[model samples]
Target chain A: MAETVDAGFLVRWLVAVAEAVDREADRLTELDSAIGDADHGANLKRGFASVTETLAKEPPASPGAVLVTAGRQLVSTVGGASGPLYGTLLRRAGKSLGEDGEVTRERLAEALDAGVAAVSQLGGARPGDKTMLDALVPGVEGLRSSYEAARAAAEEGALATVPLRARKGRASYLGGRSVGHQDPGATSSALLLAALADTARTEEA
Target chain B: MSPATGGAAAPVGIVLVSHSAAVAAAVADLARGLAGGGDLAPVLPAGGTPDGDLGTSSELIRRAAKAVDRGAGVALLVDLGSAVLTVKALLAEGDELPEGSRLVDAPFVEGAVAALVTASAGGDLDAVVAAASEAYAYRKE
Candidate 1:
């Protein structure tokens, strides 16, 4: 049977992302301390917390509404590049989802691709720049297959970011020192994708 | 402040978006001083995260941009990093600003002062944005 995504699914996915971000916040911050500000974990934690709370309070009627609300919360709550970047990702994707009652996996993939494109356009950082695009690009590509595959691709892309010289964000300020450090944005992005995959799996089970 | 001819508000308003709220406010103050410390134009500071920490907030930028807009339009001057991203995100999310508002890519401080001075003199939205953009090519030498 084909899997479908709904408003409830999006809400659960956001909750899973929040939980994952909370669990990995310390590690994310530590990674950022190497080449960028050491607030990646805390920032994401706070942003996702607000996202969950808003989701509960408003209870969007559609998947697009859920994603848009989550994105808005992130944009308002998170105090770093990650806020707008990730917020744009979800918001763009949500906009692309249209007003469909249930979204197919193919539609989800296409929307995710749009979201990743928005991140690239907003930040002007391509895959090799060692930003969130690193994980997001691959994650979108992996969506063509299975959620599990997308999760793996995102994790791999994030890991691949290590050893790349920073070319964007605060890490770029470090120049050569930015080399050999995994990008915090990419790491957190990967974690968020992984949470999405986990949510998919749980729903299927 | 005396209104313009026909009792209309200023032709242009200004918004300073920075990573630090204090920085945004300070720059607005400096720009206001350059505009003769009078209410020549509305200058709003939209900076920092919602919690008052360092970082840009798109929500804050949108609110400030709206607050300063007086039917003519608003000029947005942004600092480095996510301040630009936040504004871009705001645009991408379809949060429409008042008609004639624009984001000018110029040095934050210099562009703001130039834009403020021009707007204070009754320059239109396009002219104020031009002033800010022209600051990009300004040479210190």
Candidate 2:
């Protein structure tokens, strides 16, 4: 299987994720409205749309540059928490990718680890806090194991949100009430991880 | 388009209002992630927490408001009921509050990005906030 991920593919994947968010934005917002501010899907959609436009207009020279640019754009353009967090994730990962527009499997792993660390630093949320970290951390870890493992872990993380107490973010305000609902951030994080796994798998074939 | 056409050239910052500290922090991280590095200064104020209770929300809002010290202004995005009330209380109680800071209805992610985009693209704070509010039904990917 190929190990390197080219910048073009990375941009395409980001665009795909953005497109997915746009298409499913209403559902994402509806889910968020239940316990959040009712804007997860909507917010991501707008950010990604801009990301798509920016990437299309002037594609970055390197994978890290692409992600960093996207992250900066999201930070400057996106107003909410997810914007920065996701932006941070991409930016951190991008930073770890180096100047080369392509990433080896090892580089990918390193960049993802950097992203997870950045996310942890920015959010201060650990696993079981019912946040995106739950899904993202496991998803990144799973990449070292196998794509199937990563997919399953991400799915499990998303499902696990239903039983969590939502120790962080908007859903946590509900207190015990947040127990039964899946965290929108975590769910979305899972989707992002799943997309990465999908991309890796498809590219390998 | 030029900044003139987009909106005013207002220096903008982010406001993160969630129900919990972890969520606020996490959301803040999300915003930071989107910003790539520290390109966008994000202000995270979780409305409440399981342990911290909701009483401190007003203080958080006040602190977040202070972070948006630029001449342009700060945009506030809230998550839930008490959180909203707490932010509103802070803004109302402040006699010397900055003219640039105000709460507007914008979704968690969309609003922040819209604000950032508008501001970066040369839109004013108000225009950015207006654009951020479009997070509710923003077009898909």
Candidate 3:
């Protein structure tokens, strides 16, 4: 049953993110090299590595603090558009959770929605813009049903970005040339959601 | 954001944010030099990643804005896309930057020159931002 999750659950989710990003780095970088800058993989890997380190060193009391700390670390470390975009997602969602030690599934869903909205507001992007929001919007929406639904929706959203012309970010500069390439941001966003769903299923403690 | 070093009010401050640390620092130098030296307004560069790589750092931008702030407001000139987003992120942080500091969308070099020159002459924030923005239309043949 979808019940409540604790800070340890969030930490496990982030650790899953670090592992996923590390494993998928080459693929993400390959996608980026096709349409945008080629640093996406390395940037995310570095950011997640730092997140792993910080969460280990000085663990936060609440899930909100964990996310806020990780997000701020990414903002400080990562150095690209992804840094702020992803950072805003975690930070806003964390803020929405409001220092809760354990959060219900419904609350987590709402917080994630807020996080996605913050990303949209920050980047001025929509689903069709071929951005991280492409995955995130649907991912958070599907969380209303189940974790598996969210993961499937996010993967589908990422795949949907392949043919869309980028209307935002550095990829937009490529115009028609961007059509055939899958958006790296969308790809990484799906990875993040997958980490969440996986964490929820296996790492419940 | 203190009011100048001495006396009442000083010229509006300027910050050049570029993806390259060298570019930001050099632009600050170029603008200050062209504006008859940076004796009046505070001109600083917030650029590069934390590791001094080619990317914008919000922490760097925030620190530079704070450093250049002189109670007259800070005018930030960004070089490229991510640089703008980084500043926007810092602005979203709610109090990371001093009050009255704003990111001005203008050509990197020309805007820096115009902004610093206007600021050096003790221009207000509005005037300095106007000068930088107006530099977008500066004719080049």
- Going through the candidates in order, their DockQ values are 0.72, 0.04, 0.75
- Candidate 3: regions farther than 4 A off: B1-7
Off by over 4 Å in 2: B1-141
lDDT of 1 at A126: 92
Error of 2 at A187 (Å): 1.0
Judged by DockQ, which candidate is best? 3
Candidate 2: tens digits of C-alpha lDDT, residues A50-88: 898999999988888888778766644443567667777
In the range B59-101, model 3's lDDT, one tens digit per residue, is 8888889898878888999987688777887778877788778
For residues A59-123, could you state the per-residue lDDT of candidate 3 as single tens digits?
99999999898988888778789988899899999999998899987788899899999989988
Per-residue CA lDDT of model 1 for B1-141, tens digit only, reads 122332354568789999999999999998888777555778889978777889887778878888887777778899988788777667665645665567788899999999999888888777888889998898989
- Candidate 1 — what's its lDDT? 0.85
Which predicted model would earn the best lDDT? 3
Quality of candidate 3's docking, in CAPRI categories? medium
State the lDDT of candidate 1 residue by residue for A1-205, as single tens digits.
4478899999999999999999999999999999988988998999999999999998998888788888888887887888888998898888888788799877899998998888888888898999988998998899888898889999999999999999989999999999888999999889988998998988877
- The TM-scores, chain A only, for the candidates as listed are 0.98, 0.93, 0.97
Task: Evaluate model 2: give its lDDT.
Answer: 0.70
What is candidate 1's DockQ? 0.72
Q: What share of the true interface contacts does each candidate keep?
A: 0.83, 0.00, 0.72
Candidate 3, residue A194: the lDDT equals: 98
Ranking 1 against 3 by DockQ, winner: 3
